[model samples]
Target: MKLLLIPDKFKGSLTSVEVSKAFIAGVKKSGIPFSSHYIKASDGGDGFMNAVAHYKACISVQVISENPLGRPIQSYYLYNQESNSAYIELANASGMELLKPEERNPMLTSTFGTGLQIKDAIEKGVKNIYIGLGGSATNDGGIGIAQALGYSFLDKSGNRLLATGASLSKINSIDDTDVFEGLKQIRFFAVNDVNNPLLGKDGAAHIYAGQKGATKEMIKELDLGLRNLDVVIFDKYSFLYAELPGSGAAGGVAYGLKSFLGASYCNGIDFILELSGVNDLLTKEKFDFLITGEGRIDEQTLHGKLIQGVLALGVRKNIPVIAICGKLDIEKKELKKRGIYDVFEIQDSTKSLDYNMQHAADLLTAKTTEYFGLLLK
Candidate 1:
């Protein structure tokens, strides 16, 4: 049997590479003769930089930057010397994973840290920057990033307002007197999978703020803040990013970058697959089955996630695709309709969430062994 394993980060547990290793261990333990190949995959989320760096043999450059709360932390970006391009994943600097559950608050968090990473890359003389926008811990409408790039938000009183979700509504004007000089010379690409606009019922605050620890009231406040910021931006820049596709990505960082830095948007999965040359590999390689997975399986998985992208490739090549996740929330019929032959959950029903998370690697190994053992019969 020949198997191709491509998995995304498990989030709070195993990374894609680790997940592949566990799967390989299980397949070996099964003692079934097989040739296995694996590729680490990401949808331009948390582990995107690592995947890209590995695929391109890029150099890793680390710099000190602030976290979402303005605390100092170290972050890194992948530098491809050949292309003079840098790949930076926002989650590295402004991710929710850096905060404890109790510490998560979108109203207070900021993307300034991510902006600093971009600044650092520019300072290194990179001509192009690709920012992976996902796993953010902020809902500031990207004002924090603008602030870091030398744009100032001022209130009606002409006093500078701190760049954060709470201050979005107080903005009376934008000041770009000291904006980064090299910005116009650099090409910026915002890579993300989300398609939500910047504001509204299906937008940033309503759809993602809850996961970032926003209360019901906070969600309403954040939504209002985004609206207010949009008004200010339009008045000053003569452009409205409120309804732009993917404007809501990374808590509106996509919108901010597009509005201020002239960033273009790209589908995260497609871009990553192409950059990693996985698209070419799919054409050259043949396998009995393709296995891809992420942290969870749900309706959202159908919407441009790593699994969906992988399954699309499988469907095109007429390959059987299987998914393994920490949990499963979608109907089997729905998965079948999408070209997934089977879906496996790593956690046992009786296990506690903490227990499941702690034993994720081992559980995955056991599950893979059991599943393939059956196939061998």
Candidate 2:
């Protein structure tokens, strides 16, 4: 049998490459006579650079950037000199994986570091910048990035406020006079795989901030802050982005990008899959199974995430699709409706979360072996 393996990173645990290796190991142990083709998949999260590099000639440009909490860290983005373009992953700097779970507070984190990388690209005279807008740890609505680009958020007293989720409600005005002159000339694209709006129950704060370590009370506050920001942004720039699909992505960073930087949005999975020539391969061969997944499988997976994209491909090609995830929260009925035949969750619930994350590769291998071994034996 021929199989196709493509999965996102396990998030703070196995990278997609590592996941693929462990998966292959498991399948070998199952003693199922099978051949597999591995694709290092990315939906605008950790392995975005890998996808871009696969698509073009590019090199990494390392820079000293900051973490989500303003801690200095080493980061990099892919730069294509031939096209004078840059591909930056927000997760490289402002990602949840960078922090301990206890330290993941949306109200405190910032995307300033990602912005620094963008500024660097622009200063290098790069004309097009694509920013991966998934796996972010902040809910400040992209003001942190705008701050690095020389936009200022000020309160009624005209005192500049530091860009964070807590400050989103305090902004009385915005100033863009000091923004990089080349900003308007550069094309900005927010790449993600979600279609969440910027406000209300289905919006960024209400839907995503909880994962960024916000309590229910905090989520409400952040949502209110985002609403306040939406009004302030409209008052100053005459732009309304809150209601746009995907505006809520990356803690409303897409909304912020559109409001402050004039960014366009695209589906990350579609872009990467097309760029990596996976579409061509899918068309040329009919694999027995197309396997895809990520760290968590939940209701959100239906909302334009990587798995959704993979499922779409599976339906179009009449291929069976199996999903593997660290945590599985969706139902069998839901999976059936999405054209996914099965899902395997690899976590060992008896172990502490720390243990599970630490030994994720081994756990995944064991789980895969158990499932396939039992099924095929």
Candidate 3:
């Protein structure tokens, strides 16, 4: 029998590669006669760079950049010389993980650091840029990124304003006189997994600002600012992206890039799968079973997440798909309805959360062994 294991990072525990290794060990321990192939996957979030770096021979470039809070830090991106392309994850420079609980404030954060990385890559003569727009800490609607690229946001008095969530409403005009000339030569692809619009209830501020430390009043203010910016963008660029799918990704960075940089958006998982050549493998290889998973299995997993993408592939191939997760929150019947043949959770109910997380690799291996052993019997 042949099995394919593709899993996302277990978040605060094992990486996708580590998860695959643990499962492979479990299969061996079960004494099952099987050949296994595995791939590390990410849905354009924190592990995006690692996933791409695993399959591509690339050079790492490090640059000095500011964090969301304007603090200087070192960030890096992967560059493929052969393709003249660069892969950049916004999380590396301006993600929520970089801020402390008390320091989390969307109104004060910016995506300037992410823009700096892109600027460096552009200066390096890359013709293609793939930007992962997840795990961001800002709600600035990409104004900071624009500022970094030589676009000035000016007030009614013609004074330049600092690009931030709180300052979006004060902008009277956008000037691109000093914008980089090479931008016209490069193609920008924004990799995202969500389809939220740029404004309204399902939009950037209303749906995501609270998590970035915004209160009810602050969310309203941010939404207003986004609406104001939307008006300006439409008047100047004649493109109404506020209602477009994926415009809300990265707190409206997707929309901003689309309007300012002529960027195209694509699903993160699909992009990764294509870039890794996994789609070709799925078409040519036959497997007895396919296993995929993430940290948690819930209704959200049915969206454009990594597990769902894998399940879709399994469905097309008419192969049973199994999920092994840290926690299972959905009913088995519900998962079955979505074409998942089985689901397994590795946590011990008697254990504390810390204990389970700390020993996730061992628990995962044991659980996989036990489950496959039963299957073989």
Write the residue-wise lDDT of candidate 2 on 1-377 in tens digits. 78898787787788888888898898888988889998766777567777789778998999899999999999999999888889999999999989999999999999999999998888888999999888899999999999999999999999999899999999999988898887889999999769989999999998899999999999999999999999998898789788889999999999998888899998888888878788789878779998887888999988878888888878888889999998889786788876789998999988888998899999989998897898785
Q: What are the TM-scores, per candidate, against the unseen true structure? A: 0.93, 0.92, 0.92
Q: Model 3 — TM-score against the truth? A: 0.92
- Which residue runs does candidate 2 get wrong by more than 4 Å? 348-355, 373-377
Residue 6's lDDT in candidate 1: 81
* lDDT of each candidate versus the true structure: 0.87, 0.89, 0.88
TM-score of candidate 2 on Cα atoms, chains taken together: 0.92
For model 2, name the residue pairs that clash. none
Name the top TM-score candidate: 1
Question: Which is the winner by TM-score between candidate 1 and candidate 3?
Answer: 1
Ranking 1 against 2 by TM-score, winner:
1
**Candidate 1 lDDT, 1-377, residue by residue in tens:** 88988888788898888899998888888889889888767787778887787778788899999999999998888899989999999899999988999999998999999889888888889999999988999999887877888999999999998888889888899999999888899999999767779999878899889999999999999999999889888888799777977899888888988998989998887787787776677779778888899889988788667898888878888889989999999998899987899999989879899999899999999998998888779
Error of 1 at 140 (Å): 1.3
Lowest-lDDT window of 10 residues in candidate 3?
298-307
